[model samples]
Target: MKDGQEYLLFLTPEQDGLFGTRGVTFGKVPLNTEELEVSEDQIESSHTHTEKLRTIFNEGRKKYGK
Candidate 1:
């Protein structure tokens, strides 16, 4: 991918508090036409993850009142 180009990533959380790609061979999909077309399920999963993350963040903010 080009240096400035954006990409879509599908990741799973790791035990060490880091995220890694869902699969070793399925990492770093570009946000281009063909990639997007082939990744409908992944796109949906990304959206779900986004919502879950938002919820987690909001709960943390409330708990800490930060």
Candidate 2:
């Protein structure tokens, strides 16, 4: 997803990563910020949001003791 271009992610109730066997993969995105309007700060912010999601998943794992 681009920094400025908005998008929506839909997650089903059963698809919750919490307490599940599903594995989460964090991919490495290679982008050239010079060609786009997106800035390094904006990209960092987006990654921070994903970090929060990872934190949530970690918490869920702890809670479920999975």
Candidate 3:
């Protein structure tokens, strides 16, 4: 996805959570674009991870206050 373009990302099982204003770099994975399928389920999952990240960061800020 292009920068400044809104996008939802579903992290793999290994990923902890979503990115707030920060960005992430994924490993290079070759795939067939023709078989790509994006669904509401994936979007929701991404949203969930984003929320989780937000919560975690909030808690950290509370603790550090810096």
**Global lDDT of model 2:** 0.38
TM-score of each: 0.40, 0.31, 0.32
* Clash count (model 1, backbone only): 0
Q: Least accurate stretch of 10 residues (summed lDDT) in model 3?
A: 27-36
Candidate 3: tens digits of C-alpha lDDT, residues 1-66 = 434433333344444664332324221111222112333453355767656545544454445333
lDDT of 3: 0.37
TM-score of 1: 0.40
State the local distance difference test value for candidate 1: 0.50
Clashing pairs in 1: none
RMSD of 2: 12.6
Candidate 2: segments with Cα more than 4 A from true spot: 1-45
Error of 2 at 63 (Å): 0.6
Q: Give the per-residue lDDT of model 2 (tens digit) for 29-62.
A: 2132212233455445576775665565444444
Return whichever of 1 and 3 wins on lDDT: 1
By TM-score, is 1 or 2 better? 1
